[model samples]
Target: MKIARYEHNGFPHVGIVNHGKVNSLPDGTDVLETLNLPLDAQYRLQASAGRHHRVPLEDVRFLPPIEPRAMRDFVAFEAHITGMKKAEPGDGSVPEAWYEAPAFLFMNPWSLTAPGADIPMPPLTKALDYEVEVAAIVGTAARDVTPEQAREHIVGYAIFNDWSARDIQGREMQVGLGPSKGKDFANTLGPWITTPDELEKFRLADGRLDLEMSVTINGVQTGSDRLSNLSWTFEELVSHASRDAWVGAGDVLATGTCASGSLAELWGRAGRQDPPPLTVGDVISITVQGLGTLTNRISPQTSTGVPVPPAWSRRQPKESP
Candidate 1:
């Protein structure tokens, strides 16, 4: 089933999408609360018979499928890693540790926006980029789970756009820490979440889903790849993420950018100078087969309250004798 969170009549609601129509759940119902329940329980109470107020899809504004409790983005595709490494200033090879375990970083859940929202270009960056990915929503709480058992804990999947600031990210990585200001500004998820049952036929024997993912910028195709190209599966990512930690319902685990998923990778492959990054008024549309497309336009930069120092503020210090 395709589930969506939207605004109707000045209030937020959870609904099922059918033939471009939205059938809203009863008032005051929280979609995240239902996602926390076991799959069987969720079906019985949320997806089975319930009073639904029908609304036209065009009449409602979309919101992130759920207010995620936490967000973890994993680097599960080798092609993406290799492509990024080639673009970096060092040896273009995948790290040894990356082959042993799935690597991920926590993302700012509060930074997320819904479909059709305007994403402001953060003032700190001139090289803003977009990553096209697939994300899975955790259903039941998991602790020390195994790859074999991880699938049961996943409720649904959605398209994820992890906006990036390459210039800031490169500088931060030189300090041996993960991205901070570069990534904390914005992330986008939605259109809607497609329940796992609706995707059973796409599951491959290796535990990865066979989904065609693509991205277009202002009507031009930028990236396209098959989810099956991932080196590490979502199951492994989920199980590794839960090791000695709790992964609660409503948590999101994202597959990192796919091959050719970002301008950074494209520039590397073309062996050319970096192209102008996303600017105000540019529209980005990310589509994952069966999940739906998420479209957002870039808005003008908003104030961050932190001022940049003037060039004269960095006068060279006197050399020691």
Candidate 2:
């Protein structure tokens, strides 16, 4: 089953997509409130959505399916890791620590860009890139769940894009901290969400989903990889996330960039960038086999606020390169 949030006739709604048409949930259904519902209850809601109005899917403008309570992105693909390592000035070997456990970074949950919206470039970044991923939507609240238990907590998956600023990210990593200003600007999830049952058929012999994931920029294919390439499954990532912490409904746990899923990965593979980085007016479209395509155009920079004086007496920070 596929569920989407869209705007039709100048009004926003959440609905189920079936047979190239959208069947809205009962009128006045609160989106965030529905996230707390049990998986069975949500399925029942989808089953009853047909009782409401139905219309062509193309007639509606898509939005991010959910405004998550928290957003955590994990590095789950070895190919992406190796590709990233290759770009560094070394033997291009995978870190030994990576095999021990999954690594993740928390991102701004408030910075969601809907499919088809203009993605504004953050100020001071010229090397804009996109990370195509499969994001798992948490269904139920659980603390310290095992991988199997975490699997049960997953309600659905959506196509996720972690829009990045490579220039800023490189500098941030130099400081021994995870990405900060470089990552919080924008992260997109959309096209729609698909339940795990609908995707079980795509599982490979290794028990990983074999869904094809691809990305294109300005009408040209940039890279593609199968979801089966993910080394750490969503359940493992979610379970690790729940260790001593609570993972509730509406939280998003994303499979980080797939093999060559981002332009940064492509740069790693080729030693140097030939096509250069994204600029104004560039359009990025990402597709996950079962989920749909999410496209966003690059717009000018966005300003959260003007610079403010430092709160500390003598902790002046150096200027960003």
Candidate 3:
């Protein structure tokens, strides 16, 4: 089932999508609460939705289906890393330790931007980029779960764009502890959510989906890849996520970018000048076969205030008494 959250008449409502229309649930329905419900309960919501109002899809504004309680992203695709390696001839082949297990990083839940919103370029970055990925939303709380059990907790999937400031990220990561300052500024997670049931047709024997994912920059196609090609499945990602920690309902996890999912990856292959970095006013459209498309436009940079206070101590190295 395709579940969605949208703004209508100045209020947000959760509903099911059918035939290019959204049948909103009665007012006051909480998106996360509805998604976390048991299958029977959620089905009931879908059943009763039709009795309310079935608004044409275009009439309403789309919102992020749910506000993630927490967010985590993983590097689950081999091609993405492999392509990055190809970018730098002597950067050393994809680090050997990468094969041991998947790598993930916590993302800021507060930074999520809705579909059609103008994404402001963080002033600290000149090389802004977008990562086209697929993210899973946790349906129920769990801990220490295995891959087999992780499936039970995952309720749905959505198109994810993990926006990045390559220049800032590169500097921060070199210190072995960052990505937060660079990433916390913004993230886009809208369009809508698609339940696993609606995507079973694309599922493979190995648990990955056979969906085609692609990205375009200002009306020109830039990259494309198949979802089924990931080295690790979403199940693995969820399982690894719950290894020793708690993952609660409404939390979201993303399978990092696909092979050609980002221009940075392209820059890694060729020179940065060829494809170049994302500039202000560039429109990026990411589309996954069944999940639909998410489009966002880059706008001029904005500064709210001074970035931060002084880092060093107030006293000088050897000040006179």
Model 1, range 169-260, lDDT digits (tens) per residue?
88888989899988888999898888888788999987789999999999899889999998887888899999999998889999999998
Provide the lowest-lDDT 10-residue window in model 2: 305-314
Prediction 3 TM-score vs. true: 0.92
Give the clashing pairs for model 3: 87-268
Order of candidate numbers by lDDT, starting with the best: 2, 3, 1
Candidate 2 residue lDDT tens string, 1-321 = 688888988898888888899899876776656655666887788788857689897888988898888989999899899999988777999989999999999989989988889988788787899999999898878799998888888878899999999988998888888998888889999788888888989987666888999999999999999998899777888899999999877899999999978999888888887467999999999988989888999998777635557356456766669
Model 1: lDDT to the true structure:
0.85
lDDT of 3: 0.86
* Candidate 3 per-residue lDDT over residues 72-160, each given as its tens digit: 98988888988777655476478988898989899999999988788987887778899999999998887999999999999899999
lDDT of each: 0.85, 0.86, 0.86
Superposition-based RMSD of candidate 2 using all C-alpha atoms, in angstroms: 3.7
For model 3, the stretches where C-alpha displacement exceeds 4 angstroms are: 38-44, 87-90, 305-321
